[model samples]
Target: MIRKVFSDTGALAKAIDGFVPRQPQTDMAIAVDAAIRDQGQLVVEAGTGTGKTYAYLAPVLLSGKKAIISTGSKNLQEQLYHRDLPLMKSALGYTGTTALLKGRVNYLCPERLERQISECHRPDSEPGQLSQLVKIREWSSYTESGDLSECDALAEDSPLIPVVTSTNDNCLGKDCPSYEDCYVVKARRRAMDADVVVVNHHLFLADVAIKETGFGELIPEADVMVFDEAHQLPDIASQYFGQSLSSRQLQDVAKDIHIAYRTELRDTRQLEKVADRLSQAAMDMRLVMGEPGYRGNWRELQTSPSVEKELVRLSDALDLAHDVVKLSLGRSQLLDAAFDRITLFKARLARLKDTSITGYSYWYECTRHHFSLNITPLSVADRFREQMAEQGGAWIFTSATLAVEGDFAHFNHRLGIDAKQQMTLESPFDYPNQARLCVPRHVPETNSFRRANKLAALLGPVIERNQGRCFFLCTSHQMVRELSALFREQLSLPVLMQGEMPKQRLLAEYLSLGNALLVATGAFWEGIDVRGQALSCVIIDKLPFASPDDPLLKARIEDCKLQGGDPFAQVQIPEAVITLKQGVGRLIRDQQDFGALVICDNRLVTRAYGATFLRSLPAIPRTRDLHHIDDFLSGSDTDSNTMQSHLLDQPIEG
Candidate 1:
């Protein structure tokens, strides 16, 4: 049945335009169908252009069963729910309801909106916040889903978002006057009744954590669970399974307490004093942590005299606020919410104070104005396995880059999945003809002081020749800034940096500028699709290796060594291989897409592990000459084609 649905003259090809039959897609569909029928575990690596979304969706839709589909990000969740899933449902003629369920923060909370509007009317309110609130209030009258992404008037990075959304710590749950009209409650109720539900990884992990505590769950139980972009599960699961307390959370609780004192319990003078002290204490901790935008070793910092003193001060301030809020909890719903938040914060702080625990990373990160102390477990394998057993459903994990060097050992070890079936389906794109790979001569060492300048000098002409449809991917933010600055100085095209705006806006601006170069790190490496000639080249600064100073990586390294394993081979290289594959996968998104890849790290040729990275990439034509990049991209030099064909015949090696 699954194969017939994906065939050349099937229902999908007849109903959907540009629907060509793909064997890889059909194979994946059959595998998913069997997994769902048998209630088994499966892992699939469906490469780019394999149409994995429809491959899994068709089987799940045709099965006539309840399912939960989770993606890696909110954007993908929205895309699947709003775009892909609808198209598949229509083409396959599957009549079953589906719901797009996101975290509570994505929905507009009427209670929070009302409180913010009331607060905005105060004389000391910010100048533009009230007008923003007024615009959102007007939109709220007609918007059914209350998803804030639909509010065109609200900026993506607006300060008003946190003021107008509900978190677990701040939500009044069933006790508020607006509970009957709550958007979150309505969304969850719909999700409970829907045949299929779409969610993101964070929300799925949150549901798991909540369920473990015997509390209610956000996501409904289903007969099957499909995790798309499953490569990110281990890292995200660690966060949910561990404990964390951040300055933003602390300050948010403090603000709520002050609000309760002002509007709900005006006579509680002690509430006001303790709120101020708590806020100040949180700020003092950030100050004592020194500079921002860096992670610190909390294990070492805990014993320092200055940090220890501030920790005690912050604990005392929290205790004082908790006592004051406790005295008047029943007097105000807001006060009661604050009391619960303080209690949670106290418990988390007490857990974070314990540095004697094994198999966890004790770390703290500081932004410009906020800080977070976290304890993440080195591995989430056991917890994740236990959750799957409890859920008792067919489990399927699929991603473009899940398998490193044609093996799933690292990923399986991290998540403790012993899948009953596994498959690696290559993308059907004509990569040897569509893409060219370059590891140019005289590449600078990664640690060279003049690396950025030399790279600019070498790649500037090639980028200019291609007329600036390039992405200079980097391994670090500092590298992003450095290369972006150099390209701006050397090239005439518009240079866009990542942090300048939101990611979608940045991509829109890149497309709008037609011939622009985007320099980015992290998020840009994956989940970004720019088909056609708008994005033609991707130049990576170095191999995408996690920093040695990273706390999580450090913990994993220690744990691997303790288990008598080679940490670099088993942990670091495989991880970097997957990341490099993602960065390269960004170049060719469609069958018709053509591009050039330039990897600037000499380690590929100088180090033995380089073969692992090379063999993991697609079968792109490789070259070492800069002129070949311009020639291949422009189709100017016929000899370059011959060179490409010859290189394509050779096996990838160090």
Candidate 2:
């Protein structure tokens, strides 16, 4: 049955978007089906052009199993839930259901909206804050899922956002007044009954680590869990397994206390005083930390006395405030929510007070608006393994880059997986003919101070020849910011950076612009899918290594060294290979996709460790000459034109 479906995947591809099918995609479907049938673990390295979404979805839906499909980004989750699942359902002629569920924070809380609106009538209300609140109230009437993404006008970092969404600490669940009409409850109810469910990695990891009572438990319902971008799992799991507190979290706590107090408390003056004290303490904490993103682990932080004193005051204020608020007169949903939030906040502070967890690294990340205290585990392998065993399901982990030198040991060691059952699905795209890896003849070290201007001068003609159709990726945000300034000065094309706009809006603009260039950091390297002519070349700046001085990486390396292991090769090289492969995967998204990958760092050609990075890539042709690079780009231009014309002839599908 699975073979028949794979053979007929051509029809599935055409049903939704006029997509062309590839043999690798079909073979992957077969392997995934076996994993599901046998109820075992499977790790697959599906290359860029493998059509992974449909390949996995077809088998899962066809099997009629309650499967959880987790993607790496919101964009991919939305696409799979809204775009690919419907097509897979249609082509397989199945009538079962599908649902999309994000974390609790993604959905709006009806209780929050009511309390916020009532508090808006106070004399101290900001001029336009109420209007934005009203706008959200109006939008909520027709919003189905209550997911914030439906509100196109709302900025993600808006002050008004906390007024609408509920955090884990504040969510009252069944105790909420609007429990019957709650969006999160309704969405999860649908997911519990649906044949297939889609979620991002955050929600999946949150469910694994948190296991909060009342609403946030997600486990054992599905027989199998498919992790789409499994390379990102280790990093995400580390964060979720740890604890973090931000100014945003503290501010939300204060705001909720106000809403609850105004509605119920007799002595609102004392409530107001305590709330203001906590808010001021949070601000002072930020002020004491002078620079943005000034990071230091707890051991290093002990040397600073002023910051430590402020943190102690903040914790005491929260403790006193929680006591004062609970002695209120009336009871409402807001009161219950505020009480829970206070309890949770105090517990989190208690966790942050300790820096002696044997296998954890405690640190703080400071910014302009707030400072975040983090306690991240040095190794999440054991914790993740326990979560996996507790969940008790067949696990399938797939990504474009999971293996190094055709070995999955590094990935397995980090995630605590023994991948005796594994598959490597190579791209069916003709990489040797369609793609070329190029290194400039006179590439300089990325560390050189003059390299910024030198790189722009060298790549200006390359971008011009390709008509400004390029993606230049770098290892750090500072480097990208510098290159963006340099390129805008030298190049005539429209240049865009990551932070200039929202990620999706920027990507939409990049698509609309006929030929444009982008210089971005690691965030753009993966989970971005752009096909056809517009994205024909990807240029990387360095070997993408983590600095040994970085707090978390340093702690991790120390642990590795203490265990008598080679930290550079064991931990660093494999991690870099995974990142470099993600950047290179941007080009050649499809079979007709022809492009060149240019590396401006000469280490890939001159250093001995270069072979590891090279072997991690697909079997694409390579060169170290300027002439060969030009020839490949020229050929790509011709192929892109022909492919665009062909697409115009095909029947368009939405």
Candidate 3:
């Protein structure tokens, strides 16, 4: 028998209010608790001021059911596991076991570490590679968490991850000599016994994908799963359900083979032969991928003879690697290590070749020093639903931008949830009294790319009106750069661009400057907070739209078309609506937060779809004139009537 604590939403809210310090956080706690206790699916849209994290956590901790909380980024994962959980646990007076599970790449492998140390002593090694290996040796003894995140000296793009980490296709499982001491296996075991596990979305999707392939599972059974940043689910799911291979992986294979030969080699010449084949395969792949530049969809480039030739060479290299590994199968322990490496490489190549791209989109991406081929499933709704059913767990998907206008069709359909069970919770933060939506009238709808210059001119007066504590959000980097340069020359305020420094550091500088204008692109539009007077104005250059020509977007649209669905209505519109809401939401982050939103995009007033975007916004006082916005900011008398009169003076274009 379960002990019933709080009954309805009201009772739960009161209980939370009495315990937790913040009022809005208490409300979130109640909703989360009531939903979990009833074993129902929930969709919540909490605003920036709602204290969402504590609200969800309180109910989860008190319910006594095993819960898994999935976040969107690794940074957030660390925050939850290292900072928030311990504080919340103590404040709520609850005692429960909790564990943080990350992707396998985060942990150190003792076997791989020994091999790296051995290779560092070679005569041809890079100048600083030996010193870095020595540092790793010293750090390994004192590192209790076994997480690679603590190592600041290692670059994220280093060759270490593939060598030290295990992927599903690469892991030797219990057969490995170091299986008993494996960090990845140990972490999974700890998660199984804990009451709550914190994992990122990528890891969660990978576990789901592995389950589909009949591999061992990563996450343990849970009664409930709460996806914190629910908006990123679709894109993340596409990655897991897709196929990808990189030139870097092939190069790593060659390096590992060379290192393995130094330890155990009955025939050094054969090992050299395998290394040469692997190197040639990497070079062939690079040549086929062309010069290091953006190569869009794979279908467009699939007909190239060079690509075809390299694919054959890669397959042949894998076969040769298999033969060499087979020759040293059960001999020395080091030979066994070489066999494991070769077997993993062979299996990965086979998976890449045979992986079905029937219901998915395929693309090739090239960077400065790497080339990767990617295949992403257009939709993972059915797969997600099947996973939910198998787990037999209730889910609560919550984000500030889950609904569009008053409908949940896009979010619900994308996740394959029943519409009848979905609910939209509006922000408790007062909007009309605290915020104003200003649409500049002089902006043009011309399709010319030079409209960016016109946009900068329109933004100048609005920035002046708000005294320069502003966030100018753009849809692309090119626009951001152009507008930033214009703002620096035209406006007297200090102008900051996104790429000048790290995002967090830049945000800190902006806040410290107190009246600086920061112009940035997509990443800064959402999941950012600037309350009080630090952010009194927000200028959006245009409606956020997914590029139709983007490889991933094209693939997704094509997949939807094949399924007899309207890709624009199903995918693009809702995604943009959600993203716009996030950008607008940055303006008023607290109850005391007051600001003006100036959207330079003329389509918001000229297009029929503009109503959809408008309805999704907060019910703030709105205007489409420059003078009224100036008056409102200047503390003049401007009520709903004044806004209406100004709008009536000019004909409504749409």
lDDT string for model 2 (417-510, tens) is 8655777788778886787777777777777878888888888888878887799998877788988999998888899898888787788888
- Candidate 1 local lDDT, residue 520: 97
TM-score of each: 0.97, 0.92, 0.85
lDDT of 1 by residue, 1-654 (tens): 888898988978987888899999999999999999998899999999999999999999999999999999998999999999989899888899999888888889898888878887879988988888999999999999999999999988878889899898889988998999988888888888899999899988987875531123534369899999999998899999888999999999998888878787778799989999999999999999978879878998889899999999999999998888888968989889889999999999999999898989999999999999999989899999988887777999999999987899899999989898999999999887888888887778899987999999999988988999999999989888888999999999899999999999999999999999999999999999999999999999999889999888898999999999999999999999999999999999998898899999877866778888888899887877778888888977545356564352245443
Clashing pairs in 1: none
Error of 1 at 503 (Å): 1.2
Give me the candidate number with maximum TM-score.
1
Cα lDDT of model 3 overall?
Answer: 0.74
Flag regions of model 3 displaced more than 4 Å. Answer: 1-31, 151-182, 211-220, 287-295, 331-357, 444-446, 460-469, 484-517, 626-654
Sorted on lDDT, best first, the list reads: 1, 2, 3
Provide the clash count, candidate 2: 0
**Candidate 1: where is the Cα deviation over 4 Å?**
212-220, 638-641, 644-654
Per-residue lDDT of model 3, residues 416-480, tens digit only? 76523555556667776677777776776636668878887877877866678999998887788
TM-score leaderboard ranking: 1, 2, 3
Question: Which residue window of length 10 is worst by lDDT in model 2?
Answer: 645-654
Which 10-residue window of candidate 3 scores lowest in summed lDDT?
Answer: 1-10
Query: Counting only residues 3 or more apart in sequence or on different chains, how many pairs clash (N, Cα, C under 3 Å) in candidate 1?
Result: 0
**Between prediction 2 and prediction 3, which has the larger lDDT?**
2
